[model samples]
Target: MTDVVATTPGLFPLPDWAKEDLSDLKGHQKGDLVSGGEGGEIARAYDRVRNEVVDDQTDAGLDRFVEGQARWDDMLAHPLTVHENVETGGIVRYYDNNNFYRDPRVTGELTFSGDVAAELEAASGLLGSDADDRLQAVLPGPYTLADLASDEYYGDEAEFLAAVSEFLAGEVEAFPAHATLFLLEPSFVTNAPDDDLDERASEAIDAVAGATDADVVVHTYWEAFAEKPYAHLMDADVDALGFDFVAADREANLECINEYGTKGDVALGLVDGQNTLVEEPGTIAERVNWVREQVPGQEFDTTYVSYNTEPFYLPTSKHVEKLSAIAEAARLAATEGVEA
Candidate 1:
């Protein structure tokens, strides 16, 4: 029931500023060479949003985070959370001293809440003219999130996937009513045991599809899709499939596309979302054309351009701005190609 349009999928470059912010937060959390501590971007990455609201007395960092959650809708009111980082990986939530009212991570059911849904809707709205064209609502799929969590949650792999499916189903049903499709990322399907991977992946997809009113998309990257392991994804009741062509075997993706011919949409990720470079729009357009040839008669218009991955290069906010550029380029390419 969500608005449907033919638009390419992609993201822009990571801004330079995020690096410093990431560094600062990291230094604060673990200490530097001058002092003994665990060093990584985790803490600095944590700080960008953490330092914004809370006070000096509290775990200022955690407090700032909880405060953000309280006003998430207001913060997201802007085209962008100038104060928010778009990155998905990191601490999922921030809680009070007693662990009440926690801010959850993007990878779980927590993302399906009203506050997050409003953020997604606001982000889509920010695209302005580009909103009508195809854009995606990226969510972490059950399999990926379940796998990413500590093993303590589930009894075994089987039990783990089942619980994941149920958890995601609830989340799927909670997404904003207007969003066209929820692109669930299942990055860990590649690492799962061969025998169980596909079944687990399909169940996860089905769970989301059944749970939500929106379209469910199974997106995978950084792995080969044609291999037996990936074939399992074909079983999911997806409205479309998103493949990472930047790092994946193009032949395999094409093969899958052919095999799955028009059962749903094919979101071809030609732009590299993970890199900081402002890629040549021309090169991406040409690649989309080449992919069109492989599909023959599908027309270049049917294919949408997108990044193979998220811009993990910098902070999430900068990355989103970068992603915005990619979206513009792809839209132009698709419009022109369709007209031609």
Candidate 2:
């Protein structure tokens, strides 16, 4: 029973209480820094969004993700922009303006940097020891980072991707000692061929698996798992994989479940985190049962319900708390009919 595992939806939007403008900390500190004020505004935005989704109980869908996209654009344009500073009595500071992906000017290291580490720690604190409970850190995989940052960061994408892979390996090695599971997300892999993507991803995955002693799960979302390049991810790491049950094309999902049913640990993103519709617990339980029936034996491991995608940050604190409750309930329901 103890070995039974689960995870909440990835990337919930930052709550209003957690949101911050981050425009002020533009050029003050050097290392890692936490800011207030505008930062608080950013958190507040997410909180509000979370609240609405939970209360409205409608199918909010991916449109919710668009709000954050606006903020992301600005951040991408000026990756160095800062808001308020908290380390120095709320003074403003600026990031190196470096992209998390492979930025030549910015070293393509995957280990937790300053600001990123602080964010993880805070999220971990919120989840407490449960951070390791079906824990999955949705960090951008090195390969995807390189793909996104290539041209912008390096002249050669392949060389840059390799560098990113090495860095990602470092990050995974660090996770097992700290968190329960390492969910390396390569959202961009869906864009290219599996052969083109697999070698780099495998290098990083193997490095992370070898480096750490804990269970490792690799995931991808925001795109269909079977379409284009994603079908290849199913065969990648054999142990842990997350899929978007709701957003993934239904036909493709059936094929995916059938293909991966016998080998890997599959995570089902049944709940609508991206939408406003608050799914009923019974509906979620039914889906879990369907999966169990599809693959009768211990072909793999248990199926877990997660948000189809991360929740947007416009919801309120109350909304996030509700989501946490939904996650717990879904876990309980999932375990009832299956052998843990």
Top candidate (lDDT): 1
Q: Residue by residue across 12-73, what tens digits does model 1's lDDT show?
A: 22234643554455334221212234333442333333332122102111100111222221
lDDT of 2 by residue, 40-84 (tens): 555544335434433332222111111122233222211222212
How many backbone overlaps does candidate 2 show? 55
Output the lDDT of residue 14, model 1.
Answer: 23
Which candidate ranks first by TM-score, i.e. highest? 2
Least well predicted 10-residue stretch by lDDT in candidate 1: 57-66
The 10 consecutive residues of candidate 2 with the worst lDDT sum are: 61-70
